[model samples]
Target: MREAQFYNKIEDLIFCNLCPHGCKLSEGQNGTCRVRKVIDGKLYSLNYGKISAINLDPIEKKPLYHYKPGSLILSVGSVGCNFSCGFCQNFTISQTGETFFTTFISPEELISIALKYKEKGNIGIAFTYNEPSIFYEYIYDTITLLKDELDIILVSNGYVNQSPLKDIIKHVKAINFDLKAYNEDFYEKICHGSLEPVLKSIEIAYNYTHVEITTLIIPGLNDSEEEIDKLSLWISKLSPNIPLHLTRYFPNYKFQIEATPIETLVKLQRIAKKHLNFVYLGNVLLPSNTVCPNCNKTLIKRNGFEVQSFMTSNQCPFCSFEIEYIKI
Candidate 1:
């Protein structure tokens, strides 16, 4: 177990500042995330180096279309999450505690495993599947050990506090940030979190690395046209080049609402495209091809996770438009 970063001890209790929860815990008490705990008056990350899931997945599976298209990444994930979203897809692991089964893989061991897959086009490690920020110490240590030898990708909810967020952004090359909604009411009632910090995270992350935003379009929750408009506009204001993914949500975990309509995703895609240069529809058997924003020329054609065709490099051949993608 690693002593966690971004925490302080007050008397006999420890306050975790890793995320917005700011959970204060006495000895043997776990935080809202169910991973960090106060053990003997010190905060410890219970999930540190304890990997619950590991796989070599297509970069697109991270739903990251813009960064490193047509490449495979070594994806890794632990348990526990800061936010308690009602419709969590990975709830089985995210909501669980240290009792959940996990394999212990040190940072050096993980890097060695990644090196074995170099011929298979493994770019680097992706800290995903659960709220990675909760395992801040492990990730920070792993990235420090890597020293940019491999790419570091983060798929996160973006609910972390700025101080910790700023430190992690320096090591990551790209991120797929989940912007659940456009307003605070949806965040507080449905996600058990706030929206302002997420927006702040996106704004801060894009300045340091390539950032993409994903919003799971839940039915009757955050799928309204007005909400989509506000979200797209806010992202565009940051930079129209920021890729926005409008994913269809299925009933899962506590929220058993009906699956989001394909029509809703289609409509939201159009709404997002009006303001954003790169808008893609996910979780449906639809075209998620990336096109040149200027000339409408196809840059990358994807069929599910398979890349059927794509530009040889980051530049569009038809119009020579410089696409904002990591070409390796």
Candidate 2:
């Protein structure tokens, strides 16, 4: 158990300012995240160093198409999440605590493991699977230790507070933020969170490092054309080059809503492409290729997670159009 970073004491309760939740807990009480707790009138992170899952996955599996396209990354996830989404796919780990089976991997040991896979095209570490913002201290320590030796990526819900987000973004190279939905009601009722903080986080993150956004299109909830247009336009205002992923949603956890229609994903992708330069469909396989937004020339050909062919440089070989990609 490690002392948490973003919290302070009130009269008798400790207030956790990690995310927008601002959970106030008395002694021996856990926050809504199920990880952060109040012990002796101070906040503690119960999930620190307790890894629920780890794997070496293709960076594309993170759905990060624009950043480090073909490289593999050591993905690590800890328990607990700030949002209580009903359709959470990783709820087994994200909603559990230390009582659940987990391995204790120190920062030094994790770094050694990453270095061991350097020859296997492992670019660096990705704090993913669960909401990484809840495990801020562990991530901060590990990234500080690794520094520039390995690139750091975050797969997060992006519901973090400004101060902590700013502090951690410096060490991160790229991030895949789950935008979830554009409507405030959807955020409040479906995810038990708000939309404003997530939008704010995206705006703040892109300034420091590469940013990609993902929105899972659930059938009845956030799959409307208007919402997709608003979300795409908002992202375009930041930068049209930002890659947007429209993923299919399946029944999971508490939500038993039928899987999202492929037709909805295709329609939303077309609508998104109107404002965004790079748009891709996920989950159900369509064409997962990157094309030059200007000339509509296939720039990167991908077969599943494998990169079949791509331009040697950042510019399109045929049209010389600048491709928005981080060089691997």
Candidate 3:
């Protein structure tokens, strides 16, 4: 196990400042993440370099449409998540630790695995599947070692604290932040987290890396039109060009509410598109390809991960309007 960072010890207690939880633990206690444990009065990351899942997936699967369009990325995740969201899609891996099987791979070995996929269009490695921040020491070392050779991206819940997040964004190329809701009540009740820090995290991430937002629309939880309006408007203040994905939520983990109706997704997409230049639907069958914000031309077409890029450059082919996207 690796000794974690962004922490402090005071009067026999270890304070974990990695995320908003700010968990203070004694010997043998674990933080809210269940992966960071207080071993002999020192906080240690138990998930460091212990990979639970790995796959070569399309960049769009990270839901990152703007960065390296049509390219592939090596995605990996460790066990443990900071939040206890009832509707967590990857709860099995995200919610557990030692109970599940994991393979221990060194940083150099992991990089070797990533390079093997480069011939098949793998762009870079993504810290995903579970909360990447939970295995803070591992990802920090891996990304630091694998710097600049490939694009480093993160698919996160935006629940992390400022200091560590700033450090991570320095090397990260792009990130898809999962914004659960707009109101504090929903955050507290549904995600066991607060809204302010997530908003702050997004603002911080924007200054560094390419940012995109995703909100899983649960039936009665966070699907309100007022909330969507406020959410989209808040994102627009950062930049309307930032893509917003409205994903359809189904029964998962603990929440057994009926699946999100397609009609609701369509309606909310209209509301969000009003304040945002790019809006797309996820988890259901529909075209979520990149379209020109100025001329309404399809700049990138995606059919279940097989992407066809139409824009040779960052400018729209039809209107010649400047757009923001990274290509290889």
Candidate 4:
């Protein structure tokens, strides 16, 4: 087990400041994340190098529509998350503890696996599936070692504190930050967290890597037209060019609300488009295609996960408008 970072010893206990939770733990007890424990007066990361799942997946599966469009990326994730969102899609892994997990793979082994797939059009590694921030030890070490050859990516809730985030951003090439809502009350009530840190993380990431934002518009929770406008407006202030994906939230985990209505998804997309350049619907399909903001010409056409057609030389074939991204 690796020693966790951003912690302070408090007599026989320690306060872990990895994320906003600031979990205070007694000796032999764990933090809110359940992955950081205080043992012998120091905090340690229990899930380091203990990945629950690993696979080669499409970059689009990361829901990253703009960065390296159709390339494959080695997706990896360890258990444990800082938030207790009611709509967590991967709760079995994110909320489960060390007792239920058995996989033990080192950073070197993961890098080797990614390198093997590199020849087959894989861009690099994506820390995904669950919250990757809680497994900071393994991620930091692996990225440090593979920085020369790999482009590391983070799929996160954007709840991490600044110190650790600043330390790792140099290694990350891109990130997809989940922005659950634009209101603080929604975060506190449903997500068991605050909204400020997530916003700060997005701003920090925008300066460091290719940052894309996703807001799962849960029906009756955060899908109001006003909320969508607020969320998109905040992102637009950061950069209107940043792609904002309005994903359809399905009923999952503890949230038994009805599936997000397709009409709601389309309406949110329309509302978001008012502030952002590239807005798309995920989970359910809309006209899943990329169009030029300047000319209204189709640039790339996608049906579900399939890329059906590409026009121009990565530009709008009709208007010669340079495409913002390259099809990989």
Candidate 5:
């Protein structure tokens, strides 16, 4: 295990400052995340370098609609999460402890694996699968060592504390932040977190690196038109070109609610289009294509995670209208 960063020792207890939860623990006790433990007044991350799953996935599968679309990325994840979302898709790893699905890899080996895929057109490493925020020490070190060679992408729930987040954003090339909802009540009751911190993370991340936001639209929860409108407005204020992905929610883990309807996703996409120039629907079998904001022409065509780019730059290939995507 690796020593944690952004922590303070309160005599007999160690306070974990990695996230807003800031779990304080006595010796032999674990934090709210159930991964960090205090031993002799020192805190250590039990999940460090303890990978539970790893795979090669499409950059689009990160739900990153803009950055180097159509390319594959090396996705790596460890066990444990900081939040308690009821609808967590990867609950087997995120909710349960690290005892299950035993797998291990060192930071150097992970970097080696990522480097080997450069010829296959992989952009870089994705700290995903589970909450990489909690594994701050490992990710920080790995990305620091690999920064000169590869792009670093983080697919996170966006519940991290600001101080550590600020320290790591420079090495991160892009992020797909999961904005569960716009309402604080939803975050408090459903995700065991707050909306304000996630919003702050997004705001801070946008200025530092490529930022994209995703909201899993669950029916009867955060699927209101007002919520979507507010979310789009906030993102638009940052940059109208900021890509917002409105993903259809699927019932998983603790939440027994049905999957989001196709009609609802279509309707919200229309609402988001009013504020944001680029909005895409996810987890549904729609025509995954990019359209021009000026002439309404199809710019990029996508099937599943496969993307066919029509525009070379962030501008529309047809009418020369500007698109907000990054070109590799």
Candidate 6:
């Protein structure tokens, strides 16, 4: 295990300041993440260099509609997470302390793999599948080495502390923050984390890198119209151009409920669209192409991961309005 970063020691107790949990450990105790453990009087990362999942996936799968639509990216993930969301989609990796399924890969080796995929329209690497922040050392090392050569993206729970987030977001090209809910009660009860830290993290990332948000609309949990209105309005305060994905959540992991109704998703989408210029639905068959906010013209078309860009340049083809993103 590699020595972890962003930690403090107080009277022989190791304090993990990686996230908001601030888990103070004593003699072989693990942090809330379960990946960082106190061993031999120091904090060490158990998930460091242990990659549980890796794949060359489409950028759209990251649900990043505005960034680079059709391009592919090399996505990798490690086990362990700070949050304990009951409806975690990738619970097999995210909620586990087990590294039995993980393959050890060095930072240099990951860079090599990303470079090999460049010719096949691969943009860069995405630290995804599981919570990437728990293994802070590995991500920092890899992104530091793989700078500028390829775009770095993260699909995160947004529970990370600001200092470490700022350290990494400056190097990151894009990120999809999972804003699970707008209520504090939901976060504390269902996710085992706080909402304020995630909000702060999102605010920080917005200034440093391209930011997008994904909210898995769980039935009767976070799908309320009032909450979505507040959520979208909050995002609009940041920037209306920031794409917000309202994903349809099905029962998974500990939350065994029915799938989200299509009608419910549509209603919330309408509510969110009032505050945000770009709001799209996911996890169901829906028309989610990017349209010009000014002219209402379809700029990018997507059918299940197959994307075709109609925008020849950065501006809209029909309206010539300046777009914040590049042609995909």
Model 3 segments more than 4 A misplaced: 325-328
Please provide TM-scores, in order, for all candidate models, with all chains considered together: 0.97, 0.98, 0.98, 0.95, 0.97, 0.98
Residue-level lDDT for 127 in candidate 1: 94
lDDT of candidate 4 at residue 214, scale 0 to 100: 84
User: Which of the two candidates, 2 or 3, achieves a greater lDDT against the reference?
Assistant: 2
Instruction: Give lDDT per model, in order.
Output: 0.89, 0.91, 0.89, 0.85, 0.87, 0.91
Candidate 5 contains a number of clashing pairs equal to: 1
Candidate 5 structure quality by residue, lDDT tens digits, 21-54: 8787888988877788887678888888888888
Per-candidate count of clashing residue pairs (backbone under 3 Å): 0, 0, 0, 0, 1, 0
- Comparison by lDDT, 1 against 2, better one: 2
What is the C-alpha local distance difference test score of candidate 5? 0.87
lDDT of 2 at 243: 94
RMSD of 4: 1.7
Which of the two, 3 or 5, has more TM-score?
Answer: 3
Tens-digit lDDT string for candidate 2 (1-328): 8999989897997988889999878999999899988887788899999998999999999979888778899999989899889899999988776635989899989999999999999999999999999989999999889978999999999999999999999889999999999999999998999999999999999999999999999998999999999999999999999999999999999999999989989999999999999899999878889888778888778889988556877888889887665464
Collision pairs in model 3 = none
Q: Residues 237-280, candidate 3: write the lDDT tens digits.
A: 99989989999998999999999999999999999999988899
**Candidate 2 residue-wise lDDT at 77:** 94
C-alpha RMSD by candidate, in order: 1.2, 1.0, 1.2, 1.7, 1.3, 1.0
For candidate 4, write residues 1-328 as lDDT tens digits: 8998899986776888889998878889988888898878889999988888888898888888877777789998888888888889998888876634657888898889889998898889999988989989888889878966978989999999999999998679899999989999999998889999999999998888888888888888898999899899999998877888888888888999999999988888889999988898888867778778889876667877776446536677787777654443
Alpha-carbon runs more than 4 Å astray in model 6:
325-328
